[model samples]
Target: MDFYTVLSRYYDLVFQKNKKALSMIKHLVEIDDHTSLLDLGAGTGEEAIDLAFEGYHVIAADLNED
Candidate 1:
């Protein structure tokens, strides 16, 4: 298995979503009328998933395809 594949298995255990940052983003961006967002280098897609749940259309991109 590749390095990212191994890391992905344990990523969530070691890292959790940053609620403060997500709040900052919500304050900065207008999340209305089906707002769209592109998260480059999005790892594990935790934040993107959160934003999506909040009604924003999020597209997560990452280098590791694990």
Candidate 2:
């Protein structure tokens, strides 16, 4: 398995389940329906997934993108 694969599995340990990570990003990203976002280190896609759900055009990225 690659780094992200392992990283994904342990995501909750690295960042807690109720970690306010989403809140932090939600504040930083000023979103519009047409807005585009690139989420680096989008582990397990938590922030990116939330942003997409909020209707922003989100592109989830990782250093492991090969």
Candidate 3:
């Protein structure tokens, strides 16, 4: 298996605190339905998923496929 594949299995655990950070960022930024986000180097797509849930169109790009 590749490194990213193994890392993906535990990415959430490693970045559990990122949810709070993302929330803070959301509060600091004003995003509307028309806003589209490009999450470069997105790993495991956690942030992208959260942003999408918040109604923003998110494009998550990463070189690794896990």
Q: Per-residue lDDT tens digits of candidate 1, residues 1-66? A: 788889988887888888898999899998788689999978899999999988889999999976
- Give one clash count per candidate, in the order shown: 0, 0, 0
Model 1 misplacement above 4 A: none
Candidate 2 local distance difference test against the native: 0.72
Model 2, span 1-66: residue lDDT tens: 877677766675787543486677677878876679887776567767777888779898767643
Which candidate ranks first by lDDT, i.e. highest? Answer: 1
Q: Model 3 off-target regions past 4 Å?
A: none
lDDT of 3 by residue, 1-66 (tens): 887788888987886647786888688767875678788888878888988888778899988777
* Candidate ranking (lDDT, best to worst): 1, 3, 2
RMSD of each: 1.4, 3.3, 2.1
| Winner of 2 and 3 under TM-score | 3
Q: Which parts of model 2 have CA positions greater than 4 angstroms off?
A: 1-7, 17-21, 24-30
TM-score of each: 0.84, 0.60, 0.71
Higher-scoring candidate on lDDT, 2 or 3: 3
Question: Each candidate: what lDDT?
Answer: 0.89, 0.72, 0.80
| Candidate 3 Cα deviation (angstroms), residue 28 | 3.5
Best-to-worst TM-score order: 1, 3, 2
Residue clash pairs of candidate 1: none
Q: What TM-score number comes out for model 3?
A: 0.71
Model 1: what TM-score?
Answer: 0.84
